[model samples]
Target: MPKPSGRGAADSSYAAGTGIAGRGVLLDVGRYKGSDGPDDSWLPLDANPLEEAEPDAAITLDDLKATADAQGVRLREHDILLIRTGAIERTQDPNAEWDPFGEPGLTYSDDLIEWVHEMDIPYIGADNLAVEQIFQTVTEDDLGEGRKSLHGNYALPLHGAFLRDLGVSLNEVLDLSELAAQCAEDGIYEFLFTAAPLNFEMGTGGPVNPVVLKATDGAGEEGGSEGRRGRGR
Candidate 1:
């Protein structure tokens, strides 16, 4: 796990405004990867080829923007971005190989970092264990002379970039299949999202069950409590 450079939600002061409720957009990368196959397909998360592939197979920021545009969804400041990468679906397969050290996720690059900063979203969640691809190949040249000593050190760089630098909280290992199905059925991508984490003092992180509320009439209401309800993994 990555350490926070500053105070986190675990602090007493941070707990006051920890509960976030606002508009959320679900970017179903699984659909972009053809996981549905014209029919609702549910497979183990690791079984998904996109999630099991290497960093080269990771989704890019432009892919997300294009998908959002195609789905008629707009990215706004402070929106909670829920990315469905089909990671939870992998749990259905009992014989799947589990690799804690590696998993498929969003591509980690300066462009992605810049995009996130520009979007100004407070929280970003993904169905995968990590928000960015793990064990990415980094050469000594890639690290440059000053940072060459750190080459080959496995780390969650995105976590440090987002949580530490940008003050963005990352939610991972979410089961987004149900939410994705609901969004597809209604052709609605935005919804009222809220997450309440355990108030562990001085804790770096804790568990959270994110609640997603979508309006029955297809008009998303911010902070609205009534509608179809879905929980996080």
Candidate 2:
């Protein structure tokens, strides 16, 4: 190997920890509330499915709850929450024009941030560019008395809420199509999720390969853990 460089060598870092393994809970918001079918009763009754009117939507905490309820999943503390908004899938299509701005996914809210903290969720992942909306929405509280501004104060609030303040790690741009389809097919949303990030202790962020181990019946229809690739920019 060449001489060691910079501050450190043979070392790297990720938020909270270097690697993560946990009881992964997937809330497939795309399949549950996308521009598809409610084909069965499991679909949330009040799901504002992806459509023309709200192409640039932001999934609220209620949306997450409704999705979880529809999928029969009870959110637990320390559970790895992986949400699929289908944003990654759109990027794969040749004709589709994927716009990162105002993309539909989790956005910052008082209740949403509070719930994440109160639940003690250590990590969160999503199939979007940012786990939260890339273009954040501002409110009156952020505006204050004068036109003081929202550019900095309200831009991607979740970044500060989760990463800065809560110390929660966020994995974004995940290719969740395969996992979502598989989970929807078998009706099993919980799995053993494990990931080992490239060791870069000095760096605040690094890439990881997330693998999902799903339990199948003795019939052996499904085999073992499926390594889902992380979608790159």
Which predicted model would earn the best lDDT? 2
lDDT of 2: 0.67
Taking all chains together, each candidate's TM-score versus the true structure is: 0.73, 0.78
Candidate 2: tens digits of C-alpha lDDT, residues 3-105: 6453242222543254678999888877766762233212111123222225325677888888889989888888989988777666775654456664677
Candidate 1: tens digits of C-alpha lDDT, residues 145-168: 476666553456777778778877
Segments in model 1 whose C-alpha atoms lie over 4 Å from true places: 1-17, 35-56, 95-98, 138-154, 217-233
Least accurate 10 contiguous residues by lDDT in model 1: 224-233
Every candidate's lDDT: 0.64, 0.67
